[model samples]
Target: MNVEGRTIEEDAVSAPPPDLSEWALHAFCLGARSSPHPVVAMDDNGRILYYAVGGIDMDRLMELGLKPNESQLALMKAYRLLTVEDGRLTTSFPVVGPQVMGELRRDIRAISADVTQSIRRDSEEMCAELARRGHAHHGYAVVFGHAVDGLVWEQLRDQLPSTKLSLERPFWNGAFWAIHPRRDDAAGVNEHPWSEGTLVSVWSARIAFELRSFLTESAVGRLTHNADGVLPVIHSDDSDELHRHGKLIAERLAEAILCDPRSKALSERIVGTHPGESLLIFAHELIWDLMDCLVEATPLVRPRALDNGSAPASDLRQLLFIRQ
Candidate 1:
């Protein structure tokens, strides 16, 4: 029989069957790759969409008391993170399994430790200089403490190896709040915490503790209720009241860190077992404590004004509007 212009026997001899070696290699590569971590992504509007990972399903979510509405499912489908194939839910994304995650976590810890130490030392020096300049020391603790948290991420982010993981900084508002989600159980599906904005890391627990202290005890937070009317309706205004609020927040933060059991346990664990996990938390507390000690040891002098300029109130208000 003839096939196209060539006889069947001629075509067979010329093109022979392609070997399976290349196909076998491709299959092996796919099998050897690590699986991606299952995570839920949240948009600015607070809507969350899940990235399907193995063993997580609607039944599991229901068992855990979670009820994702139809709108959420529709949003997930829109983002292509969810799909129905043959009446089965399926999704695809890059993966890094538990073992790879552990290794990456270790690397992150090591780099974060070095960066945090350097920042702490710099913060201490800056506080000392401020004290020498006869600036009021009351607000330096919270200022430097919060600054250290941001600096740690800024410095460590570039040093760590890239992965598909999401690393978010502790949430903070310019005027008052510093928010963080509590840690979830390590072995569970983690949909609950994921929904609540918790990242997968031991450091998240530390961030939660630190932010909770600020939220509850800081003078700038809701506890003070507009700094007892000293602050303007616009919280971020650059006024004397804002400075006073900052000073009060610093003083309250210092006291809170020393008295909070969570902070104490973290400090104790720094010299106890698993120091690596507690290093950042301990460093954070130590920075605040050291600043407080510096304020107490040095005599207070007349304070000079520092630059506290910020975005215009109108511009800041625009952030509240949701962009379509």
Candidate 2:
């Protein structure tokens, strides 16, 4: 089947291979003792089906040819990221190929300039409030970023058209991208105590690869180690932080509208509900223009994190994804 002017066969041929070195570096930073092999599965027609890790059975594969183990498949299914339909193992989530990505990038960039401005205003206000409250720690910034995601979800979920396809809990809750590290058995591997950590970025499913590339190229955020893992922090003093932060927020908002099921439903509903209107223009209106109306009537505050006498920074750090 053709998608976004490209055939599935073309996508299979054009899709870049997963970067092993990048994954290895990420795993190493996470203090993983071992790393799982990343896997990509496709159908006979060259339609990409799954992008995952740790479903391969090397013992059975080397002996009897390559195949996924039944036990591992079952576990994936349990997570709702994979499914068995008509005796075939299939991906349960959406995957966007290069063609669609190109189209989305073109469409998004057209309105991203304005959207970035709106996001910058809001973020500045948020940052200013944090500073006034003496809560301008990087941890609070991270938490507020995620809280924005949740706020967006809550506002748009009910307005969106409903779909029968159920999303995985992690995806539904906006925590789909996660890093699982193996235990670090080797001692004295890390010279600095805070150097041992993992960096994770959260976004919708389809644009996972693209978003990673964007973050890498843009250098939007920096990683800081904590007891749990590494968190990406954007410092206010950095000259380009606001510009990059605004752009990153705009890109993530576009990803949600185009790729996330719930937000995509809203986009579809908007397009269908209003005929003879440009999707990009209307989307910009619905999101950026109406930002104030969409915001919660009552402002949200994490009292415990703010009130905690000891280790408020640590508390805020832990609060990043705790609500999810």
Report lDDT (Cα) of residue 304, candidate 2: 43
| Candidate 2 lDDT (Cα, 0 to 1) | 0.34
Candidate 1, residue 321: Cα displacement in angstroms equals: 24
Q: Please list the C-alpha lDDT of all candidates, in the order they appear.
A: 0.30, 0.34
Model 2: per-residue lDDT, tens digit, 84-183? 6554544443333344333443444434444445455545554555455444543233323333333343334443333222433322211111111111
Candidate with the greatest TM-score versus the true structure? 2
After superposition, which runs of candidate 2 have C-alpha atoms over 4 Å from their true positions?
1-13, 18-65, 135-147, 159-324
- Candidate 1 wrongly placed segments (more than 4 Å): 1-51, 54-72, 78-88, 91-97, 116-120, 127-324
> What range of 10 consecutive residues in model 2 has the weakest lDDT sum?
182-191
Candidate 1 per-residue lDDT, tens place, 46-91, comes to 1121213222456644554546676756654543345544434443
**How many clashes in each candidate?**
4, 0
The candidate that wins on lDDT is: 2
